[model samples]
Target: MIKITFIEHNGTQHEVEAQEGSTVMEAAVMNGVPGIEASCGGACACATCHVYVDPAWKETTGSPEVMEEDMLDLAYEIRDESRLSCQLRVTPAFNGLVVRVPEFQA
Candidate 1:
């Protein structure tokens, strides 16, 4: 299992253990982490699952694909570290990944 931490805009934090191969968005929505709307249900079509990866974890997460990159442009409060959680697959290497949700997404 991998541990994922979600920090909400209001400073609330939630941590969940996720299975490998599952997307971060899936885990968040399943765990009821307040900020992920997941309006597209992991299809990468909606930017509602947007989250900012902690800078320290960015190197491990890497950059988004062209399609995900394009979709992120429609997200509110886009940042260099912003990513669509649906596109982020969990892995043992990402066991302690941390993400912050934007205020608008909540």
Candidate 2:
């Protein structure tokens, strides 16, 4: 399992273990991490699962695809680090990934 940490807007932190091939949104939802609404599930059709990837892990997460970027435009408070958690697939390289949930998401 890959370990990931989610920091909520209120500074709450949730550490979760995710299986390979699963999306970051899946892990958060399964672990009941607050702030990840995942309203569209993992379809990348919505921005409810938005998160800010820590700079140290940004390279591993990579840039969003065009479709995801378009959806992100609907997310509140988007930043260079903003990402749709549903679009981030888990891999060994993401074992220590840390993301922050925005205020609007919480």
Candidate 3:
């Protein structure tokens, strides 16, 4: 299992264990981490799963694809480390990953 830390806009921290091969968005939603709406599930059609990847974990998580990049453009508070959580597949190497939710996602 991988450990994912989700920081909410209100500065709340929620850490949960996620199985490998599951999307970060799925793990967050399943564990009630909040802030991850996943409006289109894991299909990459919605930006509700957007999150800011901690700079320290950026290298480990890598960059998103062109499609995911396009979707992020529609997200609020877009940042240098912004990513669509649904596009991030969990792996053993991703354990202890940290992602922060934007203040606005509507």
Candidate 4:
């Protein structure tokens, strides 16, 4: 299992375990991490799962796909680190991955 930490806007942190092939959104929803609405169910059709990739793990998490980027424009508080959790696949390098959930979703 890969370990991923999600920090809420209010600073609440949720550490979750994920399968290598799952997306970040799946892990959050499966583990009941607060603030991840996942409205489109990892279809990349919505931005409710918006999150900020921790700068430290930016390279490992990488950037969003063009489709995801289009949806991210609907998210609140866009930032360079902003990403749609549905687009990030968990991998061994993401064992310590960290992301931040915004206070609001699209």
Candidates in order have lDDT scores of 0.94, 0.95, 0.92, 0.93
lDDT tens digits by residue: candidate 1, 2-103? 899999999999999899999999999989999799998999898999999999999999999999999998999899999999999998888999999998
lDDT of 4 by residue, 1-106 (tens): 9999999999999999999999999999999999999998999998999999999988888877889889989999999999999999888989999999999998
Summed backbone clashes in each candidate are 0, 0, 0, 0
Pairs clashing within candidate 2: none
- lDDT (C-alpha) at residue 80 in model 3: 91
Estimate the TM-score for candidate 4: 0.98
State the displacement of the C-alpha of residue 38, model 2, in Å, after optimal TM-score superposition: 0.5
Query: Candidate 2 residues 5-101, lDDT tens each?
Result: 9999999899999999999999999999988999988898889999999999989999999999999999999999999999999999999899999
Which 10-residue window of candidate 4 scores lowest in summed lDDT? 57-66
lDDT score, candidate 1, position 101: 95
The residue ranges of model 2 lying beyond 4 angstroms of the native Cα positions read none
Top candidate on lDDT is 2
Task: Report the candidate with higher lDDT, 1 versus 2.
Answer: 2
TM-score of each: 0.97, 0.97, 0.97, 0.98
- Minimal lDDT window, size 10, model 3: 97-106
